[model samples]
Target: MKPGFWIAPEGAEEPVNIFPIGEEALDASHKGLTASGALAKLASLDSEALARSCPRAVELLSTIAAAIGAQTAGAPTQLFRLEGLNDLERRLIDDVLGEGEVAGVVALPDGTLAQIQESVLAGIWRVRLEADERHDYVEIGAVPEIVSRAAADLTASDIAIGPVPEGTMNALPVLAEIRERALSWRPGQRSQTINFTLLPMSPADMGFLQQTLGNGPIQLMSRGYGTCRVLATGIRHVWSVQFFNAMDTIILDTLEVGGVPVVALAAAEDFEDSAERLTQIIEAYFT
Candidate 1:
């Protein structure tokens, strides 16, 4: 026979009370009921019945009641009470208990619901901390001209723009260059779609890009690599460019559709030389 199951002998024992679940056993049973559906059913019961039926359930109910009492005394709702709840259970309480003026129920930090009613009452509003509000806001900036032009030519919406740092003058040049390219673009391609790529030459460049972009959905292709797509909101220029570097092939493909200039950078050790190479490439595309 199973450990918890037993058969009764013919009047030999007190009808063998098989699996007499004790307080500890009942506590174990309550573990499964900690979920939203199970808790909801418990919440539907009266206080006396709840307390008499499941001690664990009573504990949860009493917690909610105490929280309500504290709130009524003008205290902040305690969010730490729900420590081990799963995400689904938390969300369930947030939806059902927190909706439309239910002050008796509250959501804890880990996303569990606690009912805090001293006397069964309705019309309460549980406070919830929105997910987006918990984090700091970081801004991102526009894509570089070289990348933007390439993206525009390819009709790609997703493109990446830089590692430009905050409070730097670096993004200005890139933005200006893109604008210039846009102005020089052919009239027939004025309404063309554009995308952007930013190659952050420095950490400062990355910071600048973040500040400029400002919480938009910039696709992070890899560490230090990002992409952004341009909307068809009145385009100014359209052209294509190619890079000889195999690493730059994607950008080249993105920009190759329109008749732009293929820019080449000479291999060098100095940053100035690299910048100059990029400038030459931009100039070639424009001229």
Candidate 2:
């Protein structure tokens, strides 16, 4: 155990023992997503519909698997256009790729917004790439490229330092550190996370921090026993990542300086597992 506390004067109330999560609380916040568990949730699909009419959907699944393989081998994401799908085809695709644990909104290239939802299988994402008029597509990758691009593009490099408002404590220094780290951060570099739960932050400080780094359009939710909401601030390479418990209490809060935080992105192992699991589902039901 790491034993450390703030050096304060006598009777100064250095209450820094912050981890109050009980055993039951910890148990409640587990990552309940299991590959086998996901497989068992599928009831009997309409075999006849998929076999007779949904040939294109079947081809798309196979293509997704192939693309996932490429992605595992470090290839760029593969996009399958969902344009011109008939009712049955679209429904089949939708029913098969039920919503997963991660969902978010990202800005499209044209500055419009698009909803990005992960499929039940990890690393498979449904997002509208184009702006205006439904042009949705499925991307098989660790994460959709648009998510990172939007985060990067929308993050303003210049963060202005204003006079510290009255009653605010340490927010200015924190902002300065964030600005310095964010401006110097580069791709493939290790990011820094400043934990606020351990800091002495006044309400005014928090307000000032939020006001200085205005919210960006990129917002994502990764659901588990609770939810980890990743919000991109207007400042470049700055993200506000907060984890809330079942009762909506923020168990952890931090500002991250770098590219998109890793909590929001699926991993290569996720892509591989998703590809395999979906292939198994297809073979068992659609074939």
Clashes of each: 46, 0
Find the 10 residues in a row with the least total lDDT in model 2: 1-10
Q: Which segments of model 1 are wrong by more than 4 Å?
A: 1-50, 72-76, 80-213, 216-287
lDDT of 2 by residue, 179-270 (tens): 88988999889889999888888777876777788767676778845778787887888888888778756788888898878887778788
For each candidate in turn, the TM-score is 0.19, 0.82
RMSD of each: 29.5, 8.4
C-alpha lDDT of residue 4 in model 2: 15
- lDDT (Cα, tens digit) per residue for candidate 1, span 1-287: 11101113346443222123122321232233222443355356453543344454234433443443333211222332344444543433332232211011222334432222110122122222235223111101111122233334433222245454455545566555545555555523433322333433344443343333222111111111221111111122332221213332234212212222212111122223323432332233212
Which candidate tops lDDT? 2
What local lDDT does model 1 show for residue 9?
39
lDDT per model vs. reference: 0.29, 0.71
What is the RMSD, in Å, between candidate 1 and the native fold over all Cα? 29.5
